[model samples]
Target: MTWLRALREIVRSGLTIERTRLEPLVALRAAAGVAIVIGLALWLVSPAYAASSALGAFSAGAATFQRSWRPRKVIALAAGAGLALSTFLGYLAAGHLVTFLLLLATWSFVAGMAWAVGPTAGIVSAATVAGMLVIITLPTSVGQALEHAAVIALGGVVQATLILLFPIRRWGAHRDALADALAAVADYARRLSHDPTAPFDAKPMMTARSAAAVTPSQARRRPAALHGPRGLAERIRPAVAALADPRVGAPAEGPGRDRAREVLGAAADVLDAAARSIRRGTPAQVPSGAMETLRIDEGDEVLEGPARQAAVRLASLLGEVLETADSCDTHVVPAPARGAADAPPLLRPTMFRLVPVVLRAMRRELHRDSPVLRHAVRLATVACLGYALGTALPLGHGYWAPIASVMVMRPDFHQTYARAVARFTGTLVGVALATGVVQLAHPDAYLSGGLAVVSAALSYLLMRTGYVASQSFTAAYVVFLLGMGGEAWDQTVRDRVLLTLVGGALAVVAYVVFPAWETPRLLDRLADWLAANGRYAAAVVRGYGDPAGQRRADVRQALLASRDANAAWGEAFGRAKQEPVRHRGLTRREAEDAQEAVQSLGQAAMLLETHLPERGARPVPEAARFAEALEADTAQAAREVRARRNPDWDRVEEALDAWEGADSGMDPVVRRGAELQLQALEELATAVDRTPLERDVASSRQERHARAEEEEESRRERDTGPAPPPKEEG
Candidate 1:
């Protein structure tokens, strides 16, 4: 039954598709690029050379489709260089079978380790492997090897040129990312307006943050042109999140709540409109009268004071974002602000100094406990085993087995197993379809090449839909691609299916024997999140005292660190939940409570940061003392979480009581923010103190019965009179 349940889950997950709005455009561009390059190569070059060149071009182009023009160029150059080197080495080693096998194994191991570097490196490494396999199979001398490598490099160059020619999509991607961020903000605002206590899911906001982060990497090369929209999105995220905080935006009853709801709704409408405008590359226009509600008279007090201020601030921020979106659409880079001489000089690093910094960062990952290191070793081992098995048996196209194994294995067991299943199933179905098409149509080289282009296009179209669908198209594409290279269709299909099965089996076995299970590390990851949030909260509270903006950078850095740590824990927890029952260290309910606690702490910290005025006004002495006490309490809670011990609830409650008493003479806004922070902290403490297991059933029942009887006795006393109570006391 357990196995049956697992199988059902795997199937359901594999079949679930996620559709994005821009996928069609991305797929169209990718298909056009690959098809045009392959067509030109076939027409201008020899048939065999064209096939090899087209493969390299298509692989590099596919790997870098989503990157900006600058990164695309960089990737193209890297891919070309890698392909040339692999092809030359493979050609040189082909004469000696023992040497060739050894070289292949070594290359596979190194390529497998490339996953440790990052996603871009992993893609480039895979492309190199594919190039080597293709080159080694062709009967070629040393001279021919150089020629083939040159042609392959030329293919990558062509793809890069095409990207430069068609750079419009880069801006489109940026717009879509910003729009996603704004839309997420709008959703959060709507939820908060309806109910302050409504459950807030940080996943959407986190996703937007990640998208905003990606834009900056590309902007480094063309800052003036690309940075404005990305920066606007980044600036707007915190403000929008702050507005959703119950503390910052809490309204009074009746007219106050009504006005608050109207203002929030209007802000959401404006944000959504701005997002739509950016997505469509049009001028942003707010709805008629939307901004009117945000304007507050000096004497007007219909909306609760702090909530009204928050709404006004949110409206102003939304206007700024819309203005930026308009500028982006018009391609007008905003001029740098006047009086720039008054600002501090930006600290720029020289390339020579930067190299060592990068090396140090990479070196930090070279440790026994690093997941990347462990996964790299596992991948390399599986690759070698897969290769050996393919060679030992009389399997045709033995490299496919190793390639499949390398592709299927990931850092975690859930992904590895899922990919293996998807790969095998998709390959089987794809081969059957391709076999039928070939037998019926008998496509010539040019026709087969076209079919391959169509298949590749469909693969990109459905890439985010599901692994099964994407891999199915990918398999069909490979079959057609090989046919263009003059392989027999029936034999190719059989070899592909058999080798994929063998490779997937090897991958599964490797993970079963030596798994990097996420379960055991879940506690540590959660603890890291707690500690990082604690530091973030403390830094934000301390910033209220720094009038010179001395701690502003520190606050931003701490927030980023906390976000990263939380994301890491979320990923680990997600993987842990997917594991077998016995393997999961914490139950789902326990994990949820832990995550909620961390999120509440983070929200409270963000609320403090947002409400803290610029040109910092001195907080009242009592408020200062309360801030210190809260900071201490947060630190203690972090330690308790790390140690897996119940936090001191009494101490936390005492601190809260002290903070409540210390609110005297504080600014009304400061008092409100402090009160909200105290409540959030209390919630965090409660969540942290909850044991994984519930109280004993018998004890709970007895306690409930006793409480009910006490309530009944009190009700009877109130109804009868106070005389009986007095007599009993005497």
Candidate 2:
């Protein structure tokens, strides 16, 4: 990964157009909100006020387009309120550059650190900062500032009102998340029918869990169909896995295995039906043969032990799913996916209450090495520097520099660089085209306002397509906005383009200088994932040992922890792949193999979870000790991995060997499950088994070779800079 190649990749990615599903009605609805606000402002006040309203309305609408589980109207309102507050405060400090710069730096830092909460929060917060930078410059007097802020908020109000009046695809995202989870399980069943040891990606289930966390208002109104299906989906996964597993369910290459495949096919059909029903809000259309296929005959012995129990359980759960679909309009299920609590299960705090939660999250990221903290530092530095530089330059619209910087900058290397390129390229072409249109057409104030609204609408329409697409129209919208304010198109064009370039450069350089590479932390992420999966697996095993006393809450919490760890590892690995840094502790091949082993370990746990007995049923004395040993061993292994040492599974082995055949009537199913886990763990150890010294030496040799090639490439790049331009143009 040479700098030149990375640079090429960044540009290519930034310019790439993603084909997104177009939501025309939603786009038009958002546009209408902007139009209504602009019309009211123009009729009551002036075109200038209309511009302010449009900015607020459009920005708030834009925030709704971002991926979030919260209600869109709520997002619209919050975005509006945040924009109003930022605009008002920024106005108060606008007279003094020193005060304005201080405020800008603080706001930018907070916006940057908001990533600790989530991308939706971080992106919306950054949007607010961008709004503040530009909108603050408009109002002069205190009274005028208050009026501007109020009207800006009115835009959000309009958007929210439209959403309430004309609800399109209400609760659609939640339905899709649930449907996707069920669909994933259905696909797994189908895959397992062919290959019994197939792997299932956990993303869909994790997404469904995230979607299930609703605000109190959402919980009361969520449809009954969204309730129990997710939990049913969860139960179905393990049952199918256990049934298909040769070790626990059926013998391979025999009539038993054929029966298992038949059950799997029926399960897949029923799961797919349930998924479709949930997605479309219709009754489950279970296949005619599905139920018949699942029902075992009285004398049939195709499935025995844990496998038979799994079949029975899967059939029962699938029945409930079908019943749930049929009765969704009339009744709520007693046992909900989130437990017998809120209908939708997880009740998140209201927006007002989320302030403290977000604050605590940000506090945790205040450490020196935290990526969010580093990003905050970078954001604050670049913002103030860009502002100061823009002001020092002869460019008229100095705010463009910081506005570009704020909007383009992100918490990662790839995005920060890509977005910078996108913004600059978009602004150049967009500003030029808009300026050309204005110069040639000579549109009036009202026409310009209409054009601005149209531009904003176009930007909204294309938001999901790619950053570049939306940004191009966004620049045109700004151009039309300034035209409405009576600015000469020619006078602003050069300044807009130059300032955008300056801001983008500052943002890119800032990231390069204050880098937060994920390459070095690969081992840490891998260890965290291992520890989380271990906890989840141990909790499930413990449930078998102490079913009556087992709090399902423990399993749920461990499940969430594992999901978070898996996501962190996945995101880190993705970023690391694109990074132009040498992987030190682990090679790409080793890391990937280790991840597969880890995922297989989780899947093994899911297989065991299928056969968890009735709460008051007889407890397994052997499992309780094994669970303890598993917990202790994995924790130590995680520490060993972090310390760059080869992990030893001595405790895990001891737990397995400790009481083998001690009790003559011990559960064979539990023992087999333990064996599966042991096999997976040993695979992980094999994957990363190289000694620390050997790993280091091998990594160094590889790094040296890569560095020499990169240096050679860089030397050639400098010598042949002119030849690459034609290729770039093409």
- The model with the greatest lDDT is 2
- Candidate models: Cα lDDT each: 0.66, 0.84
Tens digit of per-residue lDDT, candidate 2, span 144-178? 99999998898899899999999998778898899
Local accuracy of candidate 1 as per-residue lDDT tens digits, 312-399: 6666666666666665444534553221112232233333454465456456767877776677677767766776677777858877
For each candidate, give its TM-score against the true structure.
0.84, 0.91
Which residue pairs in model 2 clash with each other? none
* Candidate 2 ranges beyond 4 A from true positions: 1-20, 328-344, 692-730
lDDT of 2 at 202: 81
Pick the TM-score winner. 2
TM-score of 1: 0.84
Q: Candidate 2: deviation at residue 115, Å?
A: 1.7
Q: Name model 1 segments beyond 4 Å from true.
A: 1-29, 36-46, 66-70, 94-106, 109-113, 199-248, 336-361, 545-550, 581-585, 621-639, 649-664, 668-730
